[model samples]
Target: MEKPSDNSGFVDSLEKLLQLCEELGQQIDEIGACLYPPQEISSIEAALEKIRNIIDVLRGMQWFLRLMRLGGLQGASDAFLEACNGLRSSLRELASEISSSNTADIEARVENITLTDK
Candidate 1:
């Protein structure tokens, strides 16, 4: 029978998960800077491309986290798993917003509606 790996690998995976989370935050912040503080069109486009790449890596990290939890040295804590799931949800929301066309136009239209309602 093959011997199972020890907690060392599990600990390493946890570290990786933490690192990925930090990177994800940085990616989101970059996107915010591009959109907010309203930069040039070219800068926003470049930041968007970077966000897409980060998203691809984040997807892989999710898979890695799930696999580690399933075949881990020990079962991961509920809190840990929940936090990871939350991050995944946030990613989905971000994806939807970014994937939508004419976001600024839509925002402007919505603001006008709100003003009229007042």
Candidate 2:
């Protein structure tokens, strides 16, 4: 078991999560470029922007949690864990909404393009 003061694991995990958020943003951009209608693109872009904002909030929360832990605040660890879980749940739901919206159409279009280009 890792000690509470050892935050390397948490930092690494947060970094990975941030990286994944960036990748998701890029994919959204790709989908918007590929085949989404203009109106749909705007909707997707709005969601993507919200995701970017959420990522920023997550980064802020990570630093705040680290500082709180360093200050030896009571229950900081539990609070950090709870906050991380809540953010993760929010991200998951947002990702689910994005995927369910027009991802099938995007995937089908990409498949056709790939086959035709070969």
Candidate 3:
């Protein structure tokens, strides 16, 4: 099995997850630029879903890290646990919003929504 990056793997995972979220945000911004109605809800939602999945993976990793840290001086810190919970809650809310959007034509709109390297 592939071992985790470090004892603080959760922190590293958080950094990676945040980077992906930022990239997704940029994609949404670009998609919003050319689309009429100025709303690419479905594309935004697909990005959000990816972010949510990353957050979920990080949550599970944090749980394992917490278990490992049980006997250490730096046991699962409140800030770390709080962040995990917040990420989970945020992802859940984003998912709910995505589910409620009446979005379609994502594939057909791909040419319009794609961002040029400018």
* TM-score, model 3 to reference: 0.44
Off by over 4 Å in 2: 1-41, 60-64, 102-118
Q: Which has the greatest TM-score?
A: 1
What clash count does candidate 1 reach? 0
lDDT of 1: 0.56
Q: Name the best candidate (by lDDT).
A: 2
- Could you tell me which 10 consecutive residues in candidate 3 have the lowest summed lDDT? 109-118
lDDT accuracy of residue 101 in candidate 3: 52
- Per-residue lDDT of model 3, residues 1-118, tens digit only: 5556674575655567677568656754554553445456666666666656655665666554565477472544555657657756765764574466544553345445443332
Task: List model 1 lDDT by residue over 1-103, tens digit each.
Answer: 3434766665666677678668767766775565552333455455556655655565556555566557762355445555545655655654555456466
RMSD of each: 8.2, 12.7, 9.4
Backbone clashes in each candidate structure, one number apiece? 0, 0, 0
Candidate 3 — which residues are off by over 4 angstroms? Answer: 1-37, 62-64, 67-76, 101-118
Q: How accurate is candidate 2 locally (lDDT)?
A: 0.58
Report residue 78 deviation for candidate 2 (angstroms).
3.7
